[model samples]
Target: MSATTTTAETAEPAPVHAESLARLLVAGERPPRPNALRTSLTFGWRAMLKIKHVPEQLFDVTAFPIMMVLMYTYLFGGALAGSPTQYLQYLLPGILVMSVVMITMYTGVSVNTDIEKGVFDRFRSLPIWRPSTMVGYLLGDALRYTIASIVMLAVGLLMGFRPDGGFMGVAAGVLLLLVFSFAFSWVWTMFGLLLRTEKSVMGVSMMVLFPLTFLSDIFVRPETMPGWLQAFVNNNPVTHVAAAVRGLMQGSWPSMEIAWSLGWAALLIAVFGPVTMRLYNRK
Candidate 1:
């Protein structure tokens, strides 16, 4: 009995190899490289559903434009345009630009919230293209922008504001605004990925955006501003976008301003797009 016990004690268990461990991990897991278009559509639908469930998420888009048109047209209209109706013609386009750009910060906030909640991790674990997540968010946010534009324009129309550019011009203006808004959103996207918290992302976004919107010719003509401020406003990309919209809607055909706005939009996308993606992958 002692000899048998000694022989048993000398016996060893089988060693596990790296390949076996890998196979174990891979077992019952189908690597999920889904089609990119399908993945984007799937995630986009999810974003839309989230908005539907949390209807209050759109309060800013729905209510803020109306308030801005009313308040600005009433309070500043008489002073700026000599009449509220006249001011509406000038202010509507700029307000539309400002409103859409303002809402882009929400994109950063939303992305940051998803990261903090581990949704991005879940997305990575799946076999879908990583960019599909951002594409979907942006596609869904496009609908939000459309809603804001419609509300703003409708309010302006009711308040006796008319766009001399007619329907085609209005369409062109919308297209340009959307293009700028999408490109500008990349700035917030990078911030959301790099920042530690959603609050920080929002704070930083506001700090950057407030200056762009307020300092530009959004409310008044740049000529009325101080010389230094006029120079800054003239160079500000927001000012260019607003001028483009104004020219389109007011039948002034601001071709130069439109070209400048497009250039700025392209620059923003070229610079921030890759940086945001790099940070996203690192995270």
Candidate 2:
């Protein structure tokens, strides 16, 4: 009877070990393949649904762009760029770039809010693809950015800022701007995850973004700046992005600017994507 008891006790551990092994296997399968495209689309749709339900978020989607267009095109366009017409032509591209940059702050804010509220923890417990959550958020945010871009463009058109590149060129410019914004979002995502509060994410992102935008040739030609500032502006990633947009809108060939913008975007994505994912997994 003692011998039999020993055997049963030994056998009990086998089931426990098997259960543990199974759990480990499940944990190993936690993230799944990144499936960025699929995840982004799903998240984008989710964001759209949220907008549908709330409706008020569209206020920024509509009002901010119109206000920015009018303020820049009428209020400061002439003072900054020589005349309202010429300035509108110049300012439109910068405003578009600014709109894209400004919209990404919401990405960080939303992600931070989710993290703080234990929403991400709930998501982690689900059987869904892990990166899908992040991708979905980004995709939905991109839709907001797209709407903002359209509003800016429409207002620009109303202000007599015709794109020399026409529809195809304008579309290309918008596409590049979105890609750049998407890539830049990684840094903000990292910030959102690292920071304790959504407000911190907003503050840090804006602090970083302000210098990047101001130091670039967004509002004026780079050569017009002093030697040191000009050098920095010439090398700034925002400069590359802004120049690429300007070239596309103005019907100018943008091979170099495009290459630079894409290079920066790709580099940022490579660096921040894995880090953000690791942080997410830890959370």
Candidate 3:
């Protein structure tokens, strides 16, 4: 055979490397690291951008706490708790918890909006880690919760609701409240992904939280409740969390309440974190 023909015959196909073979097998393999910080920052910045455009949503965080403090102090303060001053002290913690819980609803609503708008689809199409979106949402929502907590605390202070436990104690209370809110975000995240509608997630989540808040020791002492409801209230996670906050703020360490609240937060984080992640993966 001629030299050219021999060379052509001797030529062989290129060897396939393991990495390329793996890529071919997987077909559109995602990046090994999702750059969690970048995704979180992106998600958080987008949320802030929305807030900048709307600006009114912050009103709820800023004004509602003040309004609640005033409404409870003036209207039912005297009748329920004998004086506005004592009522302010007694009710402020509950108001703080309520404010934090209420703000978390925004997480679900925002997630639902993203899903409905097909933003999540684009995210999935990218090389981003699936879990990063959820983590970013939780981080962003926590910032909103922190803002709401600060606004409520400021309003409480202005309304004569002083923490007898001093600044450190007050800070501890806020931190616990944020921890609980962070754990609760998982449930809301699951709802957002599963429901895919802001109204539905908001309505259902609020309805569930309304009972937990009212039935807990937030608005009143558990002793004041009926026997059956009191049992439930005493056992409710919100009750423990609120009691823990009040105890911390008053400088009276309620160990049992604190333990229970922390336990519940941990349990919620463990259970709902995986569950919500699974739901997100399924989607």
Candidate 4:
């Protein structure tokens, strides 16, 4: 027994060679590279997974919208519209747009966060569609925009906010908002790639967003503003977006405004999409 055990213990293992080791590690034919849609969707799923692991990220889409609806509805309600409930009719749609639009900055923040963590370096080295990564960020953020809109709509309904356009109209409005948001996100994503830090991204996004959102028809009518302010407010893309949404909700079907909104959304994508990709490629 001692002789047999010693022989087993001293037995030499098979010699390892590079070619044989590679064969053992090969995953068969290296499946064809994923297409852009597949890769983008995969990255989008990865974003959702991050949200799943850290559910606290959902607070902005939920709690923040609620607070905006409540605060704006009550604080300016009586003063602006003679009653809180009365104000909601005019305010809800605008607030909804404002809430969702404001949170878009988080896209840049997320991108910068990933870059800081070295996640993007690996992404850059992958043999996949170049724009898929940024597109994925926009697609994942679409869910957030939807959640924020739904939350705002629910709160508005509970507060006696009524829309004449009914469910179909509201749905169409939300669809349009999502479309706009999808295009608008490219702007921030570009900033995310350009800026050195997430904080810089956030700061720049805020400087732009605050003026972009507040200087429009979100809180009041453009006609009521001073001449110079009205010029900016009337031409502001947010004004067109808010007008389109409000009209849709109220069953007005503001075709001109909708066209403007869609046009602006397209323009944003056209201008920023290429810039974002270039920055991404260089980064």
TM-score of each: 0.87, 0.85, 0.85, 0.91
lDDT (Cα, tens digit) per residue for candidate 2, span 49-116: 98899889888778987888787677876678768888888888988898778778878888898788
lDDT of each: 0.90, 0.85, 0.84, 0.93
Error of 2 at 194 (Å): 0.9
Candidate 3 lDDT by residue in tens digits, 180-247 = 99888888888998895789998989898888887887777878668999889989888888999999
Q: Which ten residues in a row have the lowest lDDT in candidate 3?
A: 28-37
Candidate 1 similarity to native, TM-score: 0.87
The C-alpha stretches of model 2 lying farther than 4 A from their native spots are 1-40
Worst 10 residues of 2 by lDDT: 28-37
**lDDT for position 64 in model 4:** 99
Looking at model 3, the pairs that clash are none
Residues 202-223, candidate 1, lDDT per residue (tens digit)? Answer: 8999899999999998898888
Name the 10 consecutive residues with the lowest summed lDDT in model 1. Answer: 25-34
Task: Look at candidate 4 and give me any clashing residue pairs.
Answer: none
